[model samples]
Target: MKTLQASRAPRLFPLRLSFRFPLAALAVMGVLFFSPAHAERLKELASIQGVRDNPLIGYGLMVGLDGTGDQTMQTPFTTQSLNNMLQQLGITIPQGVNMQLKNVAAVMVTATLPSFARPGQNIDVTVSSMGNAKSLRGGTLLMTPLKGIDGATYAVAQGNMVVGGAGASANGSKVQVNQLSSGRIPAGALVERTVEAAVGAEGTFAIELNRSDFGTTQRAVDAINRQFGAGTAEAIDARAIRVRAPEPQQRVGFLARLEDLEVTPTQASARVVVNARTGSVVMNQAVRVKDCAIAHGSLSVVINTEPVVSQPGAFSGGSTVAAQTSQISVNQGGGAIQMVRGGASLSDVVKGLNALGANPQDLVSILQAMKTAGALSAELEII
Candidate 1:
């Protein structure tokens, strides 16, 4: 019995050792399968060529303001536009009439004509005051013709301006919120003409990536081919792809299915965008860093001025005079040099920066210096 028990124990030990190898292999496979990068839909990553929006602009006038309109004396264009409009309505004012208009404001109307928009389709419009108007609140925009870059009128805009802000002034002291000079009107312009598109016109449609990347373009092509058939899609360049599609009538359904196909996008280039005015810092996942050191400090200067009155004694002949006294002081913050190890990932880079106890503005300065020193292996953009 003892011999059999010893033999069974030895066999069980080997079985346990055999299981470890498979468990280790699974752990490694799990790590590879759960990578941080995720698959993205083609529609979100690219746009179909010839499918875009057109910009429309026009000059217009706003009326019925509660004494917050443009000053006609300063803005001659406003008075001219009003006069021209009145004349068109068969009401001509005499020459040198010296009309003092207070409720009229000159404005520029703008809108975006979406792709495939048909005539009579209502689109939103934006009205911006072109003159020195205090506010556009409680004002109605006149009928204005909106023209595209081709110099053809495409739509007409007319509606009441919806101001986003309000203000009050008394004795030259005023308070305001948001913006009061510009406003938007929903469904304000009726499309007068259509901007033709040639989507899949010649049995081929082009796709343009939002960002140019050869690997991503190839992946997109591969995805389309897998869903449709081999040789159905071809990569034109890093930014565009050409695909053989169905006829114009069936093109919409084909594109609908193709856009839903998911493909793993290529890794993004390492980059850091900095907003100088807002002190904002944004970095993508691919950002990396080499070993570096940073030291930051701040210096403050203060100056104070006080008026001192010099008085003479009761019987003295000296005159009293006022003298100015000034005091100046400077304070320098303590600085420490910190060692930062090389970072292979974005999180590591963030941790390294956090270890230096630097604020956003300081981080911007440090990043710029690091980039100059070649420690940062990423593009830095400031806007």
Candidate 2:
């Protein structure tokens, strides 16, 4: 009986061990597989320094309006521009002949000439009324030369305006939706020139970070060097990284691969942004707060007025007197002091603030006070 009991005890021990091993293995695997993901591609963090869009602007006239165009008398420039355009078209208006046109509005045409844009490529343009035009709906923009800051024509814009608003006015009352003075023309400008992007000249180029950070720059350099080889990339500063490229023909493929490499950026600084006009409060994950006491309350004033009339007796030969009686009252709400525990994380900080039972507008003031008192461990920015 002793031998049988010992053998049965060993069997029971093995069964219990086997059952617990699988659960322990599963817990380790779950941790490895379900950890928080934080890796982001290089392209999201930086951009090629020289590759950017250029702004182009032009002045032109919009015709075919439904009597909502600029008043020529009020905007003399509109009349002068019309005369010059007519003269160029060989339709000479007699001198001193005032032409009252109600369908022409002067406008400013604007567009962005993208990088690597070649000749004959179309781009969208925005047309804005520069005069007292009631609406720019249903107007045709004339051929206008869009020029860059260098005073060189880069594109020509001409198309029908597509206004997204509707407005009607009658009997001195006006009802409008959205905007009437500005409209967009889809694919209205033809690119006549190309802006050269000097990237990777002399077998090297620069990657500029959107925000300047030394840790992020060092991490990017290290990631690039590890992927390509030692001494392949180096940090110029906190915001720029210089990288060596392969041959000119292979540069594009190399850059495509480089942009895909994943990098984990350093944790950002704690910051709290408050929009005073909108009563908005936003904070980053790194925000924290020290143990503090806060007391918040609201004060309101009420004014009530009533008209009182005093009439003399009938046939007393006295005029009635009119008077106003006003009663003003002030009320202050109770605010109990609350003790807030020190917060080590963003969630804890939020909980501590929520305990004060303050609205967003009130929170703005509270955050400002906490920052002044050195209780809030974050940069407070009011916009």
Candidate 3:
């Protein structure tokens, strides 16, 4: 009919290009076989020893402070915490009446509590400036208490600080920005006390681990005995692990389903860190090395002084003098040897230390001369 429908539209365009090349190779083999890896959960890698965070502290008293407070006669503990809060409020003063408080200051506060935190819940304190105050901005904080580290008194704080920074000086030039002697109060304390925590009482629980490996604590005790079964968890060493739980009324739904399972941890060792004041370097994917050959070059000296004002010709009696001159210069550079090869990972030792083009402080002296010639295999640290 129209040349047989143009030969059946080129045979249905090769059967829709053979079903779009096997659905684009099954979407690239489902992204190279399901791609996952970085897993997590086990309650964000462990920590159940009575779930933590107590800290607390206290001391308080920050008052108004428009005059940048704290000079209460060279901070004699801000006039002895304002004569012990006016003798615990009975206010009897009148003795050596030397209270020249330009607006008070003496702070400290702090906070934390967290883990199950009950009593009245609030927590957020901070405060700071314990003496030379100079700037607690528009203060307030009075109530105080907070304690903990065994000194008892769980929380109390007080509020109104929030000083995110600001300063001024006048005749001596000054212009501050963020952190006018520390602040922050929001939800200023409260939690009165409750740190008991017997976790799962006698059904056994443990976990711990926030880093101590033994192959990530035996792969989190075989992913918690393969989701609770074979002897239901164990390990107890390279940072705890124990387990067995499930009775204190099913231990909070068995630790909320064993801290959402997931597992996969185990893979840290190789190290490399090196931040000696920001030349950074990091390395980790089990950092590897071995077959090396780097050569990187640099040298560079430079000097240049110059300062010659010696005019005496016009006067003849020689009177104007001042002379100094230096030049020096070295440079060096051009070395290039680079070979690298052996590197079982950490991106082949960062592509063989970026093929020796050095830089990060000359790749921290070529990875401390490839870890003093043993051809680096990891653990260098430096911090």
Candidate 4:
């Protein structure tokens, strides 16, 4: 397979939480700012066509599972596989000998042979037990051929599993963290074949932008045409741009130069994404708010229990019974609605939200209401 070779991009730290004291946390809770230039770049949003790695997967067997393998009676494949393996090793078992296995497990192995991977090059592979095996913590993968979608074998994986987790039990109960039934074997797979990639064979080539945006696509085309000529680059669609390569003789050299030319893409569309489960609110830099009024207050509904005992008429073999009664009350706390005007900056919006001092989950519902009222200038997407 093709082993893609490219310089690693610089690490980007997401603007999440910053260490601060309690008071400072409240002070900066709603204030937002974007002083960093090119927080996200156009190149980051795009990708080159035919420059992606392929996913190759195959089924294999794991041996030596410390008696934690699947029950042979249920997973018959384990017994059949073991018998076949033994026969291949010149150890034929009697036809009447019913075999039960406790150390063999069927597993699936997966690996990604990066573009331009050469023959005999080792790559890491993930071996995941697929049978009812309790754990693949200490097992060995047999020679398994990883194949591409075209059904062509590209790599061979075989190695002792390197499970980075451990678990033990005294009784029948089990407790595991992370994963013990799946392990990774670093550099355990050897590339047996290479995928042919023609970056610039005859001459012409194409660049595929990861995101489909007409404005971004047009800008990319313009950038390339400026470097070459008007007819050199053309936008095929919102995602793909075709560029006529240099003469066939200078194809490779031409591509090498083109990749380094930087072009700034258009600004992304305004959008806001909301996570329903976590109550997380994420908004793009372009997101804004219109004039609106908001008043958010917590409504606490509490139920308290008071246990009481009831006694039957004394004597006559009567027993006393205990019962619990619950008392409920609702506390609604709200104030006059605050008027928020349009063209309000993100910082202003943050200030208004922080004033409410609502919990994270409550803040989500408030934002949803604001979005539905057309006061939120960006698209609201809840996930």
In terms of TM-score, the best-performing candidate is: 2
Candidate 3 deviant stretches above 4 angstroms: 1-45, 61-70, 73-84, 87-89, 92-129, 133-144, 147-192, 196-218, 221-244, 249-265, 269-271, 276-285, 290-295, 304-324, 341-360, 364-383
Superposed model 2: Cα runs more than 4 Å off: 1-37
Residue-by-residue lDDT tens digits, candidate 4, 1-383: 99999997534322223232132243233336643234234346566566779999998889887999878888888788888888989999998887788888999999999987999899999998878998897888999999999999999999999887888887787767778889999999999999878875656678888778887788777777887789888988888888887777777666666776676666677787767887666665566778677776778899999999988996768899999999999999864465555544555555555555566677677778988898887887878
Best by lDDT: 2
Better of 1 and 4 by lDDT: 1
Ranking by TM-score: 2, 1, 4, 3
lDDT of each: 0.85, 0.85, 0.76, 0.76
lDDT of 3 by residue, 291-335 (tens): 766666889999999999978797578898899999999998947
Ranking by lDDT: 2, 1, 4, 3
The alpha-carbon root-mean-square deviation between model 2 and the true structure, to one decimal in Å, is: 14.5
Q: In model 4, which regions exceed 4 Å deviation?
A: 1-31, 36-45, 172-177, 313-318
Better of 1 and 4 by TM-score: 1
Backbone clashes for every candidate come to 0, 0, 0, 14
Tell me the alpha-carbon RMSD of every candidate: 13.7, 14.5, 18.4, 13.2
What is the TM-score of each predicted model, taking all chains together?
A: 0.86, 0.88, 0.44, 0.84
**Model 4 worst lDDT window (10 residues):** 15-24
**Candidate 4, residue 224: how far the Cα is off, in Å:** 2.0
